[model samples]
Target: MPGFTKHMYLNDLNKIKSDFSNYIKNIIQILSEEYNLDSIMYILEKYYPYECQILNEKYDYYCLKDKKLIPLNKKVRYLMPKPKSIIRGLKITKKILSKTYKDNYALNFDKNLQLENEELLKKEREPKINKIKEKIDKAKLKAQEVEPSFLDELMGLYERKRTTQKDKVYIFKELEKYYCLKVISFF
Candidate 1:
């Protein structure tokens, strides 16, 4: 059985009471087809005479089966089964309830409005990072692009006069590009 509630029924009743007369009329038609007109009419008159008056004012009517509000809206007309009948004819074989998990954006609708903002920020930073990387890569590429040559590995070696530290410095040229190799701090 589809769950029924007073709040849900009242909301639908208020909708029918406010605008759209067709909803009431459709329920009345269904009631006239299934039960005695006076019995259905008496039920409407007893509990919801105001609704009946609203229908009468608008040349409409309504009916109730059990306590469910059977609105005749085209979208929901076929859903109104008889009272006490289970809606088992439905072909549903699977039922799952979604679990809720909190996220940073869950409390902020604005965060979802700008999913592209993070992506855009990332895209914006990528080019700048790439530009810096390219400069470093170009410097290395230019060094490697030069013609190959060989030079003496050790033209000189010196030890500091005041300290035992070797303070080694190796300077050389490869393909007209100078590279400074220094042993500043040894592990």
Candidate 2:
């Protein structure tokens, strides 16, 4: 019922063929505009098998066995009930190409890809994150090891003349040394 239409099956192929062929042509046009024919053909080749499966029954009845979906053969394809929607072709094409569609990348409309990409990113970021944390830990240790004499000198600068630009530079340097204020520049 997913791909089959509510309209009577008059054994006409021209109407559906026109739209189905149009869908393929549109896909070619869209892809070819951005990529070479080889890439387009590769994608179409990868997707062509599934196209046949959709023609049988996309969302509904399918020959299943042993907890796995069995692709319907040409023999049983017509035995099943037809899809009850005329828009099935477009919907199927959209769903099929939605993952490969460039706009869907920005929209995050491909649910499966989003989850997969998120997981991959987390895995990929783990080592970089650990490296950052190690760097931060090293900086903290360095800050803590600052000599007490510098602290007294910093206090004297602040107490003697807190408003001077030179005092500010001295105070900021000490703060950076002791507190690990990474980047600071006056003037």
Candidate 3:
């Protein structure tokens, strides 16, 4: 009921009508083929089993109640039934086809609604995400603009002293005391 509205039902019925039209056109095309009655019967029996059943049962009841061998070609008109039987068959087929389409449409409708909601949420969050990104960028830029502190310079010097000259360990040991005093004074 969520996705199945009156408009949807009407649209589905229109589509089924078009599909039935195409089906009738195909049936006419098949009948127009130069195949024999046996081949025709085979095709009808294979595809339009319900129609064939109606035709056989009705014709037997109406025309061939007593007779055993009812002429296949003449007893029935084009291996199809009268208007009433054809309409009944179409109604049944339409009900089935419409139900199938409605079920499939309902399933897809939920997925589509979820996808739309996800997209909307993404859109709504985009500005906040951009603001956060902008703030982060400004922080990075501010950090870059600020000069290095004495502690950072001292750390750099210590690293260079360790890598460049292992024998200059005594010199760095003396500088370490001065560096610690400077750090304490600054803080």
The candidate scoring highest on lDDT is 2
Q: Per-residue CA lDDT of candidate 2, range 112-181, in tens?
A: 6545654654465456656766987897787764445556556556657436988777677667666422
So what's the TM-score on candidate 2?
0.27
Model 3 segments more than 4 A misplaced: 1-109, 145-149, 152-187
Cα-based TM-score, every candidate: 0.25, 0.27, 0.22
Model 1 score (lDDT): 0.36
Once fitted onto the true fold, the runs of candidate 2 whose alpha carbons sit more than 4 angstroms away are: 1-118, 145-162, 180-187
For model 1, state the Cα shift of residue 167 in Å. Answer: 13
Q: Which predicted model would earn the best TM-score?
A: 2
Candidate 1 wrong stretches, greater than 4 Å: 1-105, 109-111, 145-187
The TM-score between candidate 3 and the true structure equals 0.22
lDDT score at residue 21, model 2, on the 0-100 scale:
58
